[model samples]
Target: MNQDAIEVRGLTKRFGRRTAVEDLSFGVARGSIVGLLGPNGAGKSTTLRAIVGLLRPTAGDCLIDGAPFSALENPATHVGVHMDGFGFETGITARRHLEIIRLAAGAPPGRVDEVLEEVGLADDAGRRVKAFSTGMAQRLGLAAALIGSPRTLILDEPANGLDPDGIRWLRRFLRGFVERGGTVLVSSHQLAELEQVVDEVIVIKRRALFAGRLDDLIRNDVDSLESRYFDLVEGAQA
Candidate 1:
C-alpha cells in the first residue's frame, strides 16, 4: 500500500455545543481495504461525511490522494461514496437511477450497464427500486458508488441486508476491488465479515482509539477482531 492514500488530520466536528468527533486522525493505505469500526453513536457517519465534503469539520481536514476532497479537480473520478442514506428513488428503475448518477459523475454512457453487471443486478436493471428487497437496494447503492469508476471507495454498511451468500459475495467483491488497484475504507457492524476481508483496521469512539493491521492488533492472542473490538470500545468508556 502506498503511503496515506487518505489522511485525516486532527479532525473535529461539532453540532452546536455537542461534540461528535474530536481530534481524530488516521491514514488509509492505498490499494488496501481498511475497516472503520465503532459502535453506534461513535461519530463514524460524521467522520465519513467530513471526509467526503458532505460536511465541514470544525477543525482540521480530510485529504484524499494528498488533496482535500473539495480540492479534487473532479471528485467523482477520484472518490466513490455510499453512506447510510443512499437516497435511491424508489419509483425509478435501477438502470435509470444508475444512468442518472453516471451522467452526473461524467462517466461514459455504458458505465451504468457495467456497474449493474458488476453488482449482480444486470437482470433486474429494469425493475423499480420499490419492488426490490433490502439486499437488492444495498446492491443498487453499491452500483451507484462504482458508476464513477473511482480509485477509492468509502462505503457504510454495504452488506447491511445481505444473506450468507450475499455476504460472501460482498467479501469477495471488496477483496477483488483492492486487488485491482483500488483503495477501500468501509464501515460495517458485521465484524466477522469485515474481518475476513480487511487488511487494516481503524476503531474509533468519538475520537480515534486505534488504527493498524488486524494481525498487529490481535497479536495471535487467540482473541481476534471481536475480542479486540470489545476491548477497545469498553476501554473508551472507562
Candidate 2:
C-alpha cells in the first residue's frame, strides 16, 4: 500500500483567543503534487508550519511519511520547506547560501551546483542575495529546499514572483518531481496555474472546505476551478 507523504491530523492552532486553524486535516499521497488553497489568512501558513515542526500547535500534530517531522531520522532528507520569511544573509552569494544548506543536510558538496542549475539559478550563483530580483530570490529558496535531496517539498506561494515563463517552468518542474516518485505540498493563490498541475487540492478557511481530487472539486468540464472555488469559499462565509 502507498503511504501518505503528509498527514495533517486534527490539527488546530490558536493564538490567545483567535483560532487560526481548526481541525484541518488532509493527506498528500506519495508521488503526487497536492495544492493547498485558501483565501488570504485562511490558516494555510499555520497548517504548513505545524507540518514542518516550525511551531507547536495548540491541539494537534502533523505526520510526514507516517512520522512527525521532528521524529523523522535525518529529517532534512525527508522533507524540504520553503515559506515566507526565509531568512537569507544578504551579503552572501547564492552559491554560498546553498552550499551552507547542502553541507548541513550532509548532502554531497556537488549537489549545490546541480540544484542551482535545476532551479535555473546557476548563472546567478555568484551574485549576492541582496542583488537578486524577487523571482531570483524565489529560485534561491527552491534551491535551498532541494539541496537536501528530500523526498517531499512544502512550498508556500512559490510562484508569487515568477513571470509567465517562470511560472510555466515551475509547473513542469513540479510535475517532473512527482514523476520521479517525489511528493509536493504547495500553497499558491494562482488557481488557474495550480489547476494544471495538482492532482489533489485541499481548500481551507480556518477549516477545510474541500479535500479531494481536482476533477471531483470541479464536478465537470463546464465548471471552472476558480468558479467552483468562489462558490465554496463564499458559501462558507458567515
Candidate 3:
C-alpha cells in the first residue's frame, strides 16, 4: 500500500487558449482529508476530473496508489468520485440505487444497508430519488460513494444543497472515514464548512498557491481559511 493515496505531478489542462490548471503538483497522504480550496473557475473541478480519469490532463500525471490512473482496471474500487450535478433516475428508489451499485461492484449485500444508514438515508431508502429533497439527494450521493468502500474519495462541492444538520452529519462522517484510514479529497466553496472537518487544505488561485497543513497555512496574517482564500485570490488579481 502506498503511503500517498493520490499524487499529481506537473498536472496541466488547457481548453484551447484557456489554461484551467497549470503545473499542479501535490500529494495526499493516506488516511487524510484534503480540502481543495479555490474560487470558481480556479481549476478545482478540472483537477478532480483528471485525478479520476474522467478528463485526461493535457500534460503531466495523476497517480493513485503509486500507479497511473489509466493503469487501473477497476477504478471504482480504488477511487470513488462524486461530482456536482449527478442525479439519480427519477423512478429509482434510494435503496434500489444502492442495490444496483452493490450488484455492479459485486460488493456484499450488507454494504448497501450499511452506507444507506451511515448517510442518514435509511429512512428514505424506499422513497423514489425524484421525491427526495436536495439534502436527501446529497446524502444519497454520499452513500453511493461509500458503497465500494473505496480507499480514496473525491467529492466536489458536496455541501452545495445540504441543510445544517445534513452538513453536520457529513462532517462527522468524513472525519470518521479518515480516522479509519481512508483518504478523501473534497472541493467546496463553503470554506467555513470545510474548516470544521478538513485536516489539510490545498489553496489555489488560478494555479497552485499554497499546499500545506491547515494551521500552517492560516498562521500569522490570515485568521481563517476563508479569509486566506479571499486574500490569496485578491492578491493574485492585484
Candidate 4:
C-alpha cells in the first residue's frame, strides 16, 4: 500500500479563460491532519473537488492511497468527504438521510444511529433537515461522512457554521481520528481555528505556494496565522 494518503501531481483546472489551479502537487501523509489554506478564489475548492472525483481535472491526476478515486474497489470505505455547502433533502429526517447513505455505502444497518450519536445528533434524529440549525446541519453532514468508517476524511470549510463549542468538538474528533491512523485533509479560510488542529498545511494561491509542517511556518514568527497568511498572500500578489 502507498504510504501517502493523498497525492496530487501536476494538477491543473481551467474554466473557460480562468485558470483556477495550475500544476499543483502535494502529498498528505498517512495518520496526519493537513490543512488546505488559501484566500478566496485561490482554487482550494476546485482542487478538493477534483481530488474526490466530483470534478474532473483539466490535466494531471489526484490519487488516494496510490489509486484514482474511481479506481478504488469500494471508495466509500476508503474515503469520507464533506464539501462546502454540501446538501441534504430538506424534508427528510436526519436519521433517514443517514440511513439512505448507509444503504448506498453498503455499511452495516446500525451505522446510522452510531454516527448520529457520534456527532451528538441522536436527539435530532427524527427532526426534518429543513428545521435543523446551521450547526445541526453541519453535524449531519459530518455524520454522513463518518457512516462508512472511511480511513481518510476530506472536509471543506467544515468549521463555517460551528460555534466555539462545536469547533472544540471538531478539534477533538479530528485529533482522535489521526491518532487512530486515519488521514484528514481539511480546507478552511479560518486560519486561527485551523492552526489549532492541523499538523501541517498546504498553502496555495492558484498554485502551490507552500507545503510543509505547521511548526516550521510558525517558527520565528511572532504573528498569528491570520497575520502571517496575509503577509504570504499579499507578497505573492505583489
Candidate 5:
C-alpha cells in the first residue's frame, strides 16, 4: 500500500465571520503529485496555508507523515512550502536571499547554487530580485522551497508566471521529483497545465468538492477539462 505523504483531516479555516474552508479533507499519496483545484475564493490557498502551518485552522488538522508541520524536528528537511504572498526583499540578490534561508534552515550553503541551477536561475543568481521578471520571481520562490531537499512539497500556483519553456521544464522537474519518492501538492487554476502534471486532484469550493484520479474527472465527450471542472465546482455550489 502506498503511504500517505500529506493528510488533511477535517481542516477548516475562518477569518472573522468569513469561513474560508469547511471540513476539508484529502491526502496526497507518497511519491505522487496531486493538484489542488478550485475557483477564486474556493479555499484552495486556505487549505495549503493550514497544511504548511502558515495559518491557524479554526478547526481540524493537517499532517505530514502523520505529524503536524510545526512538530517536525527539522521542518525544512521534511517539507518545503511555497504559498501565495511569499516574497523577497527587492534589494537582495537571489543568491543572498537563498543563502539567508539556507543558514536559517541549517541547509548546506552550497545547496543555494544547486537549487538556483535546478530552477534555471543560476545565471541570474547575482541579479536583484526587483530586476527579475514575474516568471523569474516565481522560479526564485520555487528555488527557496527546494533548498532543503524535502520529501514533500506544498506549492500554490507554481506555474503562475512561467513562460511556455519554463512551464515545460517545471512539468519535467515535478515528475522527476516524484519518481525519486518525493510527494507534491500543487494548486493551480490552469486546468490543462495542471492536468499534465498531477496524478490525482483534490478540489474545493470553501469545502471538499472532489477528490480522485484526474482521469475520473475527464469525460469521453467534447467537454474540455476546464469545462468539466467548472461543471463540478458549479454543481457543488448550486
Candidate 6:
C-alpha cells in the first residue's frame, strides 16, 4: 500500500467552455489533515468530486493507497466521503440511519454506537432525522462518514451549519482522528475555521495557486489565511 493517502496528477475538469480545474496536481500524506481552500466556483468541489469518484475527470487520475480509486474493490472501506447534503432518511432515527450504513458497509455493529457517541449524537439516537436542525444534520453526516472507520475521509464543507461548539468539537475530533493515523481531506470556504485544524492546505484559485503547509502559505506575511486567500484569488484574476 502507498503511504500517500491521495494523489492527483494533472487533473482537469471542464463544463462546456469553462474549465473548472486545470492541470491540478497535489499529494496528501497518510495520517495528515489537509484543507482544500478556494472561493466560490474555484473548482474546490469539482476537484473533490473527482477525487471521490463522484465525477469523472476530463483528464488525469486520482489514486488512493497507490492504486486507482476506480479500481478499488471495496471503495467504502477505503474512502469515506461526506458532501454538502445529508443522505438521510427523514423518518428514520439517528441510530437507525447509522445502523443502515453500518450494515451496508459490512461494518461491525459496535461501530454504529461508537461513531454516534463520537459525534455527540448518541443522546439523540432515537430522534428522527426530520427533527434535526441543520447543525444536527451536519453531525449526523459526520457520524455516517466515520461509521466504517475508513482510512481516508473526504469531506466537502463538513462544517456547514455547525454552531460554535459544534465547530470546536469537529476541529478537536479531526485532530484526534489524524493523530490516530487517519487521513483527512476537507474542503471549506471557512478558511479561518479550517486554519485552526488543518496541517497543510491546498489553495486553489482559477487553478492550483498554492499547495503547502498552512504556516508556509503565510510564512513571509503575517496576514491571516483568509486575507492570503483573497490575495491569491485576486492575483489569479489579474
TM-score for each model = 0.97, 0.98, 0.94, 0.97, 0.96, 0.94
Q: Rank the candidates by lDDT, best first.
A: 1, 2, 4, 5, 6, 3
Candidate 2 lDDT score relative to the true structure: 0.91
Model 1 CA deviation exceeding 4 Å by range: 1-3
lDDT of each: 0.92, 0.91, 0.85, 0.91, 0.89, 0.87
Which residue window of length 10 is worst by lDDT in model 3?
229-238
Clashing pairs in 6: none
Higher-ranked by TM-score: 1 or 3: 1
Residue range with the least summed lDDT across 10 consecutive positions in model 4? 219-228
Candidate 2 C-alpha lDDT tens digits along 65-110 = 8999889998888999899978799999999999888878989989
lDDT, candidate 6, 1-238, per-residue tens = 5568999989999999999998999999898899998888888888888887778999998888877778887777888889974478899999999899898888998998899889998899999999999899988988889877888899888888999998998899998988888899999888789878988889886478889888887776578889888888888862
Better of 3 and 5 by TM-score: 5
lDDT of 1: 0.92
RMSD of 1: 1.2
RMSD of model 5, in Å?
1.3
Q: Using lDDT, give the best candidate's number.
A: 1
Superposition TM-score, candidate 3 onto the true structure: 0.94
Q: Give the TM-score of candidate 4.
A: 0.97
- Kindly list the per-residue Cα lDDT of model 4 for residues 1-238, writing each as its tens digit: 6579999999999999999999999999998899999888999999999998888999999999889998998788899999875799999999999999999999999999899999999999999999998889888999999999999999988887899999999999999989988999999988889989899989899888889888877877586777777777888962
All candidates in order of TM-score, best leading: 2, 1, 4, 5, 6, 3
Q: Which residue runs of candidate 3 sit more than 4 Å off their true CA positions?
A: 220-222
Residue 33 lDDT, candidate 6, scale 0-100: 92
